[model samples]
Target chain A: MAKPLILVSNDDGITAPGIRTLVEVAKKIGEVVVVAPDGPQSGMGHAITIGNTLRLDRSIAFDDLDIVAYECSGTPADCVKLAKHHVLKDRKPDLVVSGINHGSNSSISVLYSGTMSAAIEAAIEGLPSIGFSLCDYGHEADFSHTREFVEQIIRQALQHRIPENTSLNVNIPKKSSEPIKGIKICRQAHAKWQEEFDERLDPRNRKYYWMTGNFVNFDKGEDTDEWALVNNYVSIVPCQYDMTAHHAIAMLNEGWEF
Target chain B: MAKPLILVSNDDGITAPGIRTLVEVAKKIGEVVVVAPDGPQSGMGHAITIGNTLRLDRSIAFDDLDIVAYECSGTPADCVKLAKHHVLKDRKPDLVVSGINHGSNSSISVLYSGTMSAAIEAAIEGLPSIGFSLCDYGHEADFSHTREFVEQIIRQALQHRIPENTSLNVNIPKKSSEPIKGIKICRQAHAKWQEEFDERLDPRNRKYYWMTGNFVNFDKGEDTDEWALVNNYVSIVPCQYDMTAHHAIAMLNEGWEF
Candidate 1:
């Protein structure tokens, strides 16, 4: 049997340690192709390059590993589009994986995640996809402990296939002394970033603001991604691109006069 | 009773005619505040400014109407964040509204919409929010006919508060000789953009690509937003930030091995 073709991308750029780790693991499983941002695109969400042109260049980042890779001057979502419609052309990838991101994309953070945006973009294009993230924010975050779990999840995803029109948001706990309990298929927790803007002045005395925020989890449900991550289990939340609140339809129909 | 304070924003920048129409409608209902992007940030989705400092400058655009307005050097989501955290300060807005966008943001376009991003950002911040879009994409789209519907929707939203944690994604059909039938409380149609990148060369002979696509609606459902729009009805889809595919959770739990 031919090896499953896996397309790899990330928000932390093609050269980031996270994508390198993902490439290493992906190559061992199948044919791997990397199409990622040329620079860090954290919190890019589902942004695409519309008002500007995109430049896709061949990257030497994965040359040593004998893997094909391209760096794009666009958002994570744009990289996926370029990969699908430009680079790969007619060659369809069996699975699309994004990240091994150096930070958490659990709960409300998913709305602001470029890592998951890549995965979700692939899903929108009717491909099975998964986005992996580590709960560590360090520049040199330890991905060693996540390798085995990432491999396992990818293998299972390729085998079972992801749920229709959905991408898996898998967040692994950072390297800790304790072993991971197991994997938990969880719902997105109800949470938000309690934002605070730090006001500052530049040399010209012009005021600017830096957005800073703390994650606040309001959901105490054990079946939530936040709960799974807090309990040291790999959290997998099946994320769908359809933003419609189906339950609210009836409410609006009943209450709204128009 | 005191007038309801309405916070207004858009992705088409501070000076766009789409926002001017929104302001014209919103101010009639309540005290209005505008915080929007300094330039076009279309297709920005739910992006936030994390890697850079944000600049918020007072706008003279709304000066004639004596409306308080500021333009931010960031995405639509960033403007909402600045409005909630810094600009508005202790005063909580009774409602938040974004866009009478220059183009359509129905079906899958919602995933790439900065117009909806501002409204969704406000929703995450626990505010009743609605994003309005005109199906016309012309530089000078006819928003004259949309005034009554916009005003009606805003009034209804204020009188009967929007569903919790959900923002309304309302798309008004382009003005035609035939009057709009009515409004439809609809679900987002299953659709996607069939993207084709137009390869081009820069002046320096470097390769660049322009992302272009045609919207394709796969859903034939009468209850969908696409159907409503096609049939000349204003479509209102209640959008939620939670991307979780809850039904797929049970499937993953049963099918996948740990």
Candidate 2:
């Protein structure tokens, strides 16, 4: 008869509107304990600060929820690491959720996303996890339309359960004329970011460059995350981090002559 | 028949002795082209620079090899992105190999390795790829013993070709008085990093934490990356980026009515 114990995190720092929104939605479903990065970690991917130390300072940002929230001075993966071993050592969370990110983490964006990295870290710990992201990349991107969908998915995940070794990558389309067209189960679109760097010079005239890129979705398939997002539906792509190409194993065996 | 156009890259930067040795070995097997990060990118994982500009500068390090080499001001994955879309646009690499990384990229290290990410990026591009790492992490890590192993694998790979969607995660244990105990096609060991931070006070008296961790390999399976490394053997685990837990899918389907 107890509510699910949910471990919440995000790539957009602890005080970011996105994670605050995530914490609010999660608290309604269960006990929410948040451990997230102290700063924006948008394109951090699966990085862990191994060569540096980590700091987890308690935050009063979400006092309304009466939740235990910590701002970690590390990557999203490091947040999960600290939460599991240090913060929540005695109790195991029923589900771990990350993001409600400020930008899109659909398709190949997932590969470069720290939002999903937090979820992937939990999956590595054998916990059922999900990462959520919005297509809009704004500080105060409206998340009102996503609240219902986010709550429904979390509730269902607790009532049922996701598969092992698999974590859900849920991406919501930006503010739309129509409310979300409902959730669509889809695979990650086969896509990549086409890189284009903008060279800049500081006030002192030292050359520096700002990294920029455009997302190119070559996959026109309807069953992909890109297609789902374009159709005004939140896409739930069950992602795994094992990276074992099972299809190529047999062929490699044939080619590898000892 | 024309030789395979091999794109070589790594995480220890383009100048690390590890990569120089890798390029030396790769030149024998194919038309090697080096595209790696300009500086050390240890533990970078699958990161791609998005909020900043990426620059690609030709390298003089491999001038002797007559190979086209570029040093990208980005992560390992970013290097591959530039190589594919910008540098090698006309010809797709027949094989993409990354790292003779100066450390163990076995088991859980795979998730945090910039080396493996390049290989995974190549696999995503539908090219046969592999990542090679030495068990040694020292700057002057001895690579004499790795030549035979590296050459043999690439030759076999180029001749027969690797399986689709898979890339090799090869690790060579440090050279010893004994010959290698041969290769073990193994799975990633179940492991986790027990992290502890070393906090320090800055000049302004603000506390900052430095990241540190000890790897713990809990999986005692005989056929695992950790076991192979420990037993003085090379570990070759074929890894793919698809993270779907196919077996768990059936279970989730039966349990979760959604």
Best by lDDT: 1
Candidate 1 residue lDDT tens string, A1-258: 999999999998887899999999999999999999999999999999997999999999999999989999999999999999999998999999999898999999999999999999999999999999999999878999999999999999989999999999999999999999989999999999999999999999998999999999999899999999999999999999999999999999898886
- Per-model TM values vs. the true structure: 0.99, 0.90
lDDT, candidates in the order shown: 0.95, 0.84
* lDDT by residue (tens digit), candidate 2, B154-251: 88778787776678899999988988988777778888777665668878876667767798888888877889889998888888665645455456
**Interface RMSD, candidate 1?**
0.7
lDDT of 1 by residue, B13-34 (tens): 9999999999999999999999
What is the Å distance of residue B19 in model 2 from its true position? 0.4
lDDT of 2 by residue, A1-258 (tens): 888899999988988888888899999888999999888887888988866556778988787778889899888998998888778978999999999899898887787789999998998888899999989997668998888889988987887788766799999999968877778778777786665545567787655555566778878789778998899988888887766665555565565678
Measured against the true two-chain complex, the DockQ scores of the candidates, in the order shown, are: 0.92, 0.49
| TM-score for chain B in model 1 | 0.99
